[model samples]
Target: MSALALLDYASVFVFALTGALVASRAQLDIVGFVFIACITAVGGGTVRDVILDRPVFWVANPNFIIVASVAAFVVFFTAHLLESRYRTILWIDALALAVAVPAGVAAAVAMESVWPIILIMGVATGCFGGLMRDVVCNEVPLVLKQGELYVTCAFAGAGAAVVLLTLGQPLPLALIGCAAVTLALRVGSMAFGWRLPVYKSRPPRV
Candidate 1:
């Protein structure tokens, strides 16, 4: 497999693990866990593909499904061993976001689209699956809440990729730069408790 394809596969597996972790915490059954994992692994790619009018990548490759299923099953059976390592979960999530964001950007760039669409696709690939997973688990989506610099980091990385590509940088180098920036921003946000201000509505008049 190509380096980009390998990175995409790794990201999918990591995201699948994150989904299984959430489902297990929510006390979901095995089927539900697998369902969530599938969503988390492929949801972003599905959205991206639909928007780009391309065939969904996972549909064309059954290995993605197999990997997601196996990840869910492993996490389901071994959740207790992982329960106390929430930080590790967050780090893995950051890694997945880093890798997937660049992958999405590369896909759009390969299609010869402009920078704006590429950045949007990158952010969608990085954040949308987690957003859907959180909503399904009855929690505030992390990117929508005042927790950390989640989507912001994704955007920054994606934008970097676009800029580098526009500047005639090599594709692999551009992807690496984007992923590194994403990982740094995400990990820093978590480590330093960097959060955007919460939006507060005014009280109703009497």
Candidate 2:
């Protein structure tokens, strides 16, 4: 398989895993698990494809759906075994974000889109899936988590790739840089209590 295809598969599987975990938290049935998983797996890429005016990935090829369904089925049988499903979901989503950002970057690069478009596509591809899953599950969207480094990581990663590509670096190297920066920032935030400052309401401005 091509590198881009591999990235998409990786993103699909991991994102589906996170989605199924969320469904488990929501106490959804097996069918619900599959439904949520498929949506989460393809949501971001679907948005990206729609905006780009390309054939949707899962529509053109059903294997991605198959992969998501299998993941949901596995989670359905084993989710209760997880001591902390939320924590697992976060880490897996981090991996999904890392993979998906590069997949988006690769897609935009393939289309020869401008740098800003490439960056936005990367963030959208990494974020929209988890956002959909959380919204559907009635959980707070991680992308909107206060002080979290989610979308920031994606943007920084995509920005890094764009910079390198502008400097004439090869695509593989740029992708690697993107993944590295994204994963590193996300891991740092999750593992080390690193967070951006949030707004504190001011009461006396009036």
Candidate 3:
């Protein structure tokens, strides 16, 4: 398989794992696990494709769905083996974001999109899956969290991809660089508590 295809499958697997983990944490059943897994795996790509006026990716190839379901099953059976379940979820989500960003950017680039749209699609690809996962798991989406660097990391990585591509870097190389940048930023935040400044409400003057 091509590198991009491999990246997509790997991203889907990780995202599905996180979703299944969330379902397990919520004490939901097998069906819930699969449902959440599939959504988290394909939600971002589906949104990107729709916005780009392309066919939904999973509709073109059902292997993505199968991969997601398999990931959910694996996580369901192995959840107890993971001691740091929350930490695992965070790591997997970060990796998924890193890969999905380039996957989104590739689609836009293929369509001959302008740089701005390319960047937006990249961020959307990285973030929308997690957004859907959180919503379905009854948690606030991470992207909406005040002071969180989740979406910021995605934007930086997407922008980096665009810059690299503009400089005539090969797509695979650009994707690797983009994913590394994203993963580093996110992991740094998790390890060092790096965060954006939170909004401070001021009292109105009388």
Candidate 3: tens digits of C-alpha lDDT, residues 49-100: 9999988889998999999999999998999999988779888888889889
Best by TM-score: 2
lDDT of 2 by residue, 1-206 (tens): 87788899999999999999999988888999999999999999999999999899889889999999999999999988988998999999999999999999998888899999999999999999999998988898999887778898999999999999999999999999999999999999999977778777789655
User: Between the candidate structures 2 and 3, which one is better when assessed by TM-score?
Assistant: 2
TM agreement with the true structure for every prediction? 0.91, 0.96, 0.94
Weakest 10 consecutive residues of candidate 2 by summed lDDT: 197-206
RMSD of each candidate relative to the true structure: 2.3, 1.6, 2.0
Weakest 10 consecutive residues of candidate 3 by summed lDDT: 197-206
Query: What clash pairs does model 3 have?
Result: none
**lDDT per model, in order?**
0.84, 0.93, 0.89
Between candidates 2 and 3, the one scoring higher on lDDT is: 2
TM-score for predicted model 3 compared with the true structure: 0.94
User: In model 3, what is the error at residue 127, expressed in angstroms?
Assistant: 0.5
Model 1 residue 11 CA deviation in Å = 1.5
Residue 119 local lDDT, model 3 = 96
Decide which is better by lDDT, 1 or 3.
3
